[model samples]
Every structure is written in C-alpha cells, then in structure tokens.
Target: MSAIVNRLAPANAVVPEQQPSAVAGLRLETRIVDGAEWDRTIAGFDEVCQEQLHVFATARWPSVKQEPMLFLADGQVVGGSLMMVQPLPLRIGHIAVSKWGPMLKDSSAPHAAALRDAMVEALIADYAERRGLMLSVLPRAALETDNSAYERLLARGFKRGSELGFPSRYIVRLGLSDAEQRKSLQQKWRYHLNKSEKAGLSFEHAGPERMGEFDRLYAAMSERKQFPDHSAYDTVPLLMALDIETLRPELFFVRHAGEVVAGALIFKAGDRAVYLYGATNDTALPLRAGYFMHWQIIRWLRDNTRAGWYDLGGTDGFHGLHQFKKGMVGEAGVITPVPPVANYAARPWAYLLGNGAFWARDAAYHIRRVVTGALRPKARPDQAPVVVEAGQP
Candidate 1:
C-alpha cells in the first residue's frame, strides 16, 4: 500500500558515457509530487534528515519553491533530496539549496561512494550546466570530515564557502550498552546524573498536545537568558500536526514536585536522532532536572529507536554549555561540520553577478547581527545543567 513507485528510464535513454565512472548506470529524475507522496518516498530512504522532509522544508522556507529529486540506478530508487530554489536578484538566474541531504537508502553500501558521486554530477548538470543556476549544497554535519562526497563536489568545480550547515557539535554514539553509555559520561557528569536520579524527578514522553506547554517553557527561558530564541518552536507545532510519522518529534519532559521542570524535543530520521530544542526553568537547575532529562532521553533512544547516534545540538559560544555537552559526548564524539559548497552557473557573467550579490547579502546580515548585539557571547551560569535549544550559529 506504499505510495512510492519505481519508474524505469525510457528505452531510448542515453547513458552518461563521458561522465565519471559513477555516473554510468545512474539516472536522476525530478517530479512534481504532492505532500503525502513526497513524505512517503523520502521516508522509505535509509537516511532521512529533517531538512529534507516535506513538512520541515515547507515550514522552514515558506516562500521558496521546493522540488523533489530522485536518484536511481538499475531502475531502483536509491536517494533523493527536497531542494529549495530561490531566484537570484534581477533575474540573473536561481540558487538551488539542498541542506543536510540528498539522503541515500544505504550510505554504508558498497556502491555508496559511486552513487554519491553520480548524484553530485547529476545535481551539477541539472542546476548549473543545464539550467544555469548556482547549486549550493550543505551536507549533513556527520559528513564534514574527509568525506568522499565533499571531495567529489570540489572535483566538479564546486566552490567552498565559509558558511557551515552546522557548527561543532557533540553526538553520543548509542551503540554502547546502557552501563557503558553512562560510564562514557565525564566523571563529574556521571556523578551529577546519579544525584539527579535521587532527586525525586519523573520523566514522561509528552504528546503533541503538550506543545503549548513546551512553548511556554521555551519562551520563559529565552526571556530569562536574554539570548536569541533559536529553537524550532515556530515549526514544531506544524510538524506535530502532520500525519507523517517520519517528521514527528519525540518530546520528553521532566517533572519535580508534580510540576514540569525540564523538557527536550528530539527528532529522529535515518540513523541519527537530533536534539532540536530543550528548556529548563529556574527550578530545574536546583533539582538537576536537565541531567535526569537527558539521561532518560539517551536511554529511550537506545531502547526504542533504530538511531545509532544522537546529536546534542550546538552550544553556540557559551563556555559552560560547551563543557556540559562535551562531558556528555566524551572525547570521540565532537565534530566540526564541513563548510557549504557551491557550483556556479556555466556562464561567466552570471556567476560573477550572482556570487557578488550573495556575498553582499551575507555582509549585510553580519552587520545587522553586530548592530543587534547578537554576536555577543553570554557566559552560562557555572551550575547550569542543560543546553538551551540551538540552531545554526
């Protein structure tokens, strides 16, 4: 009863003989799809990221046009991305952005490298060479290291930019046994976790109806910290309201003295589960509710989901927050994302004008941030137990 269907290329289809070895037997297809179908198709993939989901993209970029792209080899769908297309100023062309995607059915497969290369080449051909748009791709944070996909992108003339999709983050590897996972925590972190367990706190898997309560907690925390509200609060409700199971977030709450003290929202897609937003009130710090809340989350992910890694999100520039996350991630889980890369239009003038305008916009954005004091780093209270909600820094 699944909506996904595999379509073969026409009999007269031309093979990409001149392209890289990976491009052979690989075909990329684009289709206009409804929301249900889009969700169904992508959900079937092995690694689905929130950014590549229909609900997230529609909520995150309401104005930009979204296109669904599918990758196939030997007539079977293997990978795809929900691409966001933005028109350049003065009608120069367009900028196609793909964030944290195109997800594959099995990134660990033997043919993954070649499939990824073919996807990159197809992306360039469709967006840059044929349609004459700038194709900008920001791979998932985990792909930041000596990734073959990134190297392939550079080999195909994609220019690397300083903009990163994710800053340095901490991810807990969930493959460890429960005892080992706890032991992996820093000595102090484990001590506090034990203390929190004895503090008479309770944990619950909150339902979508509790989103209003979460928003209230988040709003109060943002006001108290005087920091920017980077949580996905605006989009959480919409995603929660959807029928699509892949995009629904898992909400965990901690209660002390019969009152909610802390809560964390996590989204799982593919093999990774990410901490989207977390909040704690003043009462939470005293009870060490944050520690209790995260421990429960870790245990839940390990017991329930197929996810192998849990991202703790970013810490921005807060020292205490960074230390707390580092303790949770241990030494081996810290990761710095690769910077975004862009493939420009085939025409020289279009590339120059388009690149110039994009930089101009970036400069203005930084100026605005400076004027608004958004770049100022606030010191986290030494005893603060949990990280606030985070997004791209």
Candidate 2:
C-alpha cells in the first residue's frame, strides 16, 4: 500500500518568495512560546480548536518539535497557528502539519479574507520555501457559502489531500438563546430529551476525580458491545488536570439510581467547544442519557465558557451516531472542514515522497478499523453501542 498525501501544485505554478513576505500589511514571524504564552496568544482569536492548544499538542505529540507562528499587523497580533514538525529520514526535509488554523482574530471583518491569505502565504514562505519542508494545513474554514479560504489555498499552489479519515463535523451555533437552542433540536430529539428529564436521571458537571467512574462505565460498555475502545482515556485526565481554568477540559456524567451510566469529555478553546469522546451503557440508552448529557454540556458551555459554537466531532460512518447527531443540530449544522492541503515548498520531490508515505499509512488504518468492526460479535438485544465521537490528534 502506498502512503498518499494531498496533491501537489501544478508543476509550472511559480513558488512564492521563500523569505518573510508581508501580505496586506501583515507580517508573519515565529516565536518561542511557553505554555502560558501559547494560551495567552490564542485566547484572543474568535475561533480556536482543541488541536491548536498547547496541552493538546503536548499530549498528542510530546516528542515532536512544535513551532508557534503569528501574523501581526501594526505590531498587533491578528492570526496564529501551532505547527508540529517531524523530520524526514536523513535530514531530507521535515513534514509540517497544522490542524484547524491559522485562526484569525476576527473572521467577520471586511479585510478578514485578505488577512487569511496573508497568513497562508507567510506559512508557505517560512516553512516551504525557506525551510524546505512539506507543509500540510487543515485550514479552519467551515463548509459554507463563503469558500474564499479554500480557494485561496488552491490559488497559492497547495495540492488537495484526502480527509485523512474524518471528512466533516456537525457544529451548532451556541449564541442562540435557550429557547432558540431548544427550538433548533429536531422534533424526535427534543421528545427524547423531554422523556429523559422525566426519567429521574441526574446530570452533573463532574470533576477529574470522577474519571474512575467514567472509566468503569466506558469499559463495561465496550465489553458489552464488543467494539474497540478508541476514546482519549489516556489524555483526558491530563487535559482535565490543566492549571489553566478556562482551558481545562470538562467532564460530564449522567447517573440513574445514583450509579453513573454515561459520560462525556468535552474540550474548549477560543470560541469553540468540541465533543471529544462519549460512552453510554445499556442502562443509559433506555433513559436516553446521551441526549440529556449533551444538553447539559451545551447549557454549561453557554453559561461558563461563552463559546459560540459546539462541534459534535466526526461520526465514523456509524448510521446511528450520524442520526443521533443530526437530530440535535439538524442537517444544516453539518460541516465538512477543508481537507488537508500540502505545499511542496522548494523540495517538491521530498514533499511528494513524505505525503505518499502518510497516505498509505492512513489508508491501511481505515481498512483495519472496518475489518475489525465487522468481525465484532453482536451486542445483546437490550444493549446499544456506546456513542464514541472520533477525536483528532
């Protein structure tokens, strides 16, 4: 199997200047940022995904070298990204990847589009041309009527890449009033929530100390359904224990008869909150605890984080999970992120080889997941599969 990466630019497209280049009055530069500095810088952005956070990078790629780059205008920060770089064999070059960035300070401003282009161009100048690295970016643009960000990447000689596994997410706008939020729920979903409320189920915003309870429920559900446990169990505790108050991940649980039956781990950064992982046992399914758990988390986000959006994460081709998420956010909330696009930089041949290796490895992983899932034994008639959202690194 060949590892595939995003496609490269047309062989004839002229590469931009390799040095620091100003675009639309924005100057791009790199900085040596500690955890506090990284957190403080990203706090001002309007949209920040968990992948861009320092804790996430530390936990997901502890051994990889990370670079923090910022886009400044008039000596003020306007955009930034946290990039993780892995050196290719024998110093041929490095493969640099940025997920859900470079995030802009104000994406709704009149000059926001131009600012975004400048950020992308600067990345190209520094990583691709000057450093001769293969840079792949998952730009933080939604699948919306406005696609200028996607277009800009292509215009700048980036090659389109595969989804790398996840293609889309369902994001619900959280700025709505409580009444409006409920109104947005699909009719059947609303009904389930109503029923769960009458079922004597108790929802709590739990702390990291209750992780033991969550682990037990998750393990029980996994065994009952005979499915692989892909939850971020190892990293959840670390995120939950972060010293930063606003940046810490939240753990929520739903209990029936004083026993925990379901749990969810959510991570928030900037104005966005993402559903990282979830699990429910048979006891929870009957009570519709999943719906109730998510609702409580949504309300908590509204009151505490003031986050503007909630991402339900990827559904992993599970029909039940897709239907479940669609009921909460509706079809309109579904969004496919821009696929990772790569710039070959100065060493086009090196980029091609590195991306090829990545593509092959990703393809093989999905194939194995499909095979393993199919071979799992059927669950008991009364049991339902645990709801696990596919999380990104």
Q: lDDT scores for all predictions?
A: 0.71, 0.69
- For candidate 2, lDDT tens digit of each residue in 327-368? 887533545444556444557675786687677767887777
Number of the top candidate by TM-score?
A: 1
TM-score of 2: 0.83
**Residue 40 in model 2: shift from native, Å?**
3.5
**Model 2 CA lDDT for position 48:** 68
The candidate maximizing lDDT is 1
Q: How close is candidate 1 to the true structure, as a TM-score?
A: 0.86
For every model shown, the clashing-pair count is: 0, 7
| 262 Cα displacement, candidate 2 (Å) | 1.7
Q: What lDDT does candidate 1 reach at residue 267? A: 85
Superposition error at 137 for model 2 (Å): 0.6
